[model samples]
Target: MNNMIELKNIIKIYNSKKKIKVLNRLSFSFKAGKIYSLVGPSGSGKSTLLNLLSLIDIPTSGNLRISNRNIDFNSKSDNDKIRAKKIGIIYQDNNLLPDFTAMENVYLARLSIEENKKKAMEDAKKLINNLGLSNRSNHLSSELSGGEMQRVSIARALINSPDIILADEPTGSLDTTNAKEVFKILLRLKNKNRLIIFATHNRYFANMADCKIELNSGKIKRATNARIK
Candidate 1:
């Protein structure tokens, strides 16, 4: 497998009232074609790591390479372009626009990468139907159930056909049944050409990943042959 993303001695710090260190000289390489689950207690820097991976946050120091190319964090436009072309992010809150219908929310994501509305809508409709949300595509975010909203969010994330999918507590707010359903949809998205990484507190879902990694005190401990049967 190719190394999709590589971090070299990355460090992240927050200096507010007190100097707080989140990730302390952490380094890891993520490869394509695998689903990695980041499991940790609250405040353990799982979300922080994902943010850095998504280029949503820059490391305080050290290097980040994606697709074997070093990232130039100083160039905001380049980062935005890379993010739009290579990264797809899903948030715990389902970040859908309240005023837009599910179809609109999903298709609007394509505007960042594609200019044609007709093509974008066609792609969005296929994704919505594939995710079994064809009937709910016209419903506003406020009108859909939590699981339905999450499916819409997933469709939005996939609209650009990103190479890497970063999901942070994707099912954290759902009930057990809905969480399982959402996870099933997520697992189905894994392929040999893309990378899927998610942060989760649910052990069952975490164990379903191809690799299980535990983060504690800003450090990572990966399990050997952790893929569940």
Candidate 2:
């Protein structure tokens, strides 16, 4: 199996006024072709762990390897390049450019790695169309509804054809119908060569994953496979 990401004795501490330990020596290996659900309560550091995986935040002490390559947090430029090329992230809050149209928001992500605007827009259009946003692609981000914005955010994240996808409460704010819609799209994204890790509080969604990883008190409380028959 392909080990997409490996964490060794990882720890995260925030030193503001008081030292708050978020992750306590986390060590785990995530393989490609599987979906993992990170289930934890509020302030359990689910976002913190996802941030570390995406290279947006570095751990206090530990070794992180992605696709067999060691992560060098000191190399900001290189890290940015790696993130642009390999990792896709879907935030709970759709972080789109308020002034840009839905299509523009999606295509701009491609401009980071290449200078081909034509191909970028074409790819973005295809993604948006695939997500059933062909009629709304030209609409400004501010004009879209919660579900539309979430779909656009997903299109942007997949623009790079990333090896790993990290989603933080992808459907948390949507209604039941929209949540199911967004979640169905998310489940369809799984492939043999891609690793998907999502954080969720909903038990129904958590159980849908291949494995459920529970976090408590700054450490992994339990990890159980759902398909262990």
Candidate 3:
């Protein structure tokens, strides 16, 4: 598989009361066709790293390349286009608009790529039905249960058929049963053209990944099944 994401000497610092280094010379290359579980303690810069991968944030210093194109962080419009076409992000909160129906929430993402409303709705319904949410398609997000809401979130994430999936604590809010079910759906999403990375504290979920990446004191520490350089 080709390298989907590449980082060189990546460093991130946050300044408020003082200068805090979150990622110190973190360098890693993530390839396509793999599921990587990001495991780290709280405040270990897991979200910071995800933000970089998703093109939502830039590093203080270093290089980032995605999908074979070198990223120019200063080009906000170009980066936004890359994110819309290549990256799919899943948040812990499911981030759905409360007033929109589940179908609307999913189809809205499709508009970022195309202007055809009818085609977007058809594609959205197919994705939702595939996710076992057809019955809840018309239900308002506020009326859906936590698990159902998360499923809708997944459908939205897949709407663009993104090449990279960045999930931040994807199942953190659900009970064990729901978390497991949701994760199963997430794992089933992997394909040769996609690179899936999810951050989680759950050891069980972490172990299921093809590779385990532990962030310790702002560095990428590889554990079991990791063959990346």
Candidate 4:
């Protein structure tokens, strides 16, 4: 299998008045083209792990390589470039710009990676349509329903054609039907040559992943293949 991400002896620490260890020498390798679900109770370091993977937060100690290149977290520009072009991140909260229209939000992601505005708009239009937001493209994020907003978020994430997608509770805010719709789009997006890492508390949704790893006390219990249909 082709490796998309490699984490070796990773450690994360939160320090203010005291030091709190989150990840304790965690080691794992993730390959492309399969959906990976990270399951854990609240504060089990699932968010911390996803933050590190998404390059938004740096690991206190460890080596992180993406697409075979080691990342230097200290360089903001370098990280930004890699993140915009190589990775797509979906937050639990739809982090859409409330003032921007759905099309604008999706187009912004494409523009961040590509220089040509016309090309980006064309691509964004297709993605918005595919995500079932074509009719709402001109509407501001605040005007859309919860599910519509989430789909727009997904379209924005995919606009850059990222090799790795890091989704944190992607369906946490949607209704049951909407959640299922979102998951279906995600599963269809998964290929044998890309990586999809999602963190969720929903067992039913987690069971749909190719591999499920439950996190507890900064460590993974075990990783197993899913048997659910």
Candidate 5:
């Protein structure tokens, strides 16, 4: 299987007044065309692990490679380029620019990769329609509902045609009905060959993934067989 992301003996630490270890010699390889859910309680280092995988945070020690290329933590410019081209991140809060319209938010992702404004807008519209946000494309972030904003966030993440989507509790704010709808959109997107990995405490939602792994005390427990489809 072709791997999209790899982590080798990764370690991350935090220090304020005292040193705190977040990740301890962690290693994992994520393959393309698979959806994996990271399950654990809050403060279990799920978000930290996702941040490390997404290249938003550097490990204190260990190796990280995306699409088989080593990521140099010292190279900020190259890391930004790799992130813009290959990784998409979604946050639980949706993190929409309250000032920008839904379409603008989605289009911005494409703009980060290409400078063609016309083409970017066109592509963003297509994604909005596909994600069922075409009607609200002109609406500001404040005007959309929780689920709608989340869909917009997903559309933005996917508009760049990224190879990997890292979602941090993507549906944590939604009700049961909206949560299911959001997952449906994610499942559809995952079918297009992008690796989907998310951190979530909801076991019901985690069961929908092809693979499930638990994190505790900065270590990944064995992945067990879960609902696969």
Candidate 6:
């Protein structure tokens, strides 16, 4: 299998008054055409690992390669461009702009890669329709339900057609019904050339992944019978 993302001896540390280590020389590789579930307790560095994978946060000491290209953490501008072009991020909070409508929220992300408003809106509309959120496209973020807002966020993430998607608790705040619905949508996005990694505390959702990874005390372990193919 081709490795889509590879981390070599990754270490993340936060220094305030004292040194706090998050990831301790962690190494892993993710392959395309698979969904990975990162399972761990609240403080087990799940979010931190996702942040690093998304290039939003840098590892204190490590080498990260995406699609065989080495990442230069010191180049903020370059990393930002890579993120906009190749990486999509979904947050648990749905991180939509309160003042923008659902349509605006989804299309605005596309503007980063394409400056044409008409083209961006056209693509966003198609994604929104496919996600079954067309009726709520004009509604403001605050007016939409939690599930609706999350659907919009998913549309936004997909608008860029990224090769890798990093979702941090995509359905953490939703009810059981809504959470299952969102998970189905996520599963439908799986493709032979795309890699989807999500961090979740829900066991049902985790088991649905192609591989289940457990993070503990800055280390990672693959659970038994993980369906990696």
Instruction: Estimate the Cα RMSD of every predicted model relative to the unseen true structure.
Output: 1.0, 1.3, 2.2, 1.0, 1.2, 1.5
Residue clash pairs of candidate 6: none
Off by over 4 Å in 3: 226-229
lDDT of 3 by residue, 13-129 (tens): 998799999999999888899999999999999999999989898899999989778999999999998898888899999999999999999999989888999999999999999
How well does candidate 6 score on lDDT at residue 74? 97
Specify the highest-lDDT model's number.
Answer: 2
lDDT of each: 0.91, 0.94, 0.93, 0.90, 0.89, 0.92
Q: Which tens-of-lDDT digit does each residue in 178-222 have in candidate 1?
A: 999999999999998899999999898888999888988777866
Summarize candidate 5's per-residue lDDT along 38-151 as a digit string, tens digits.
998788789999888888888899999888898899998888888888888999999999999999999988888799999999998999999888899999988999999999
lDDT over C-alpha atoms for residue 40 of model 5? 82
Q: Among all windows of ten consecutive residues in candidate 2, which has the lowest summed lDDT? A: 220-229
Q: How far is candidate 5 from the true structure (C-alpha RMSD, Å)?
A: 1.2
Worst 10 residues of 5 by lDDT: 220-229
TM-score-wise, the better of 1 and 5 is: 1
Q: Which residue runs does candidate 4 get wrong by more than 4 Å?
A: none
Give TM per candidate: 0.98, 0.98, 0.97, 0.97, 0.96, 0.97
Q: Which portions of model 6 miss their true places by more than 4 Å?
A: 223-229
**Residues 1-229 of candidate 2: C-alpha lDDT, one tens digit per residue:** 4999999999999999999999999999999999999999999999999999999999999999999999998998999999999999999889989899999999999999999999999999999999999999999999999999999999999999998999999998999999999988998999999999999998988888899999998889999884333
How much lDDT does candidate 6 score?
0.92
List, residue by residue over 122-210, the lDDT tens digit for candidate 6.
Answer: 99999999999889999998899999999999999999999999999999999999999999999888999999999999988888899
Q: With candidate 1 superimposed using the best TM-score fit, by how many Å does residue 161's alpha carbon deviate from the native?
A: 0.4
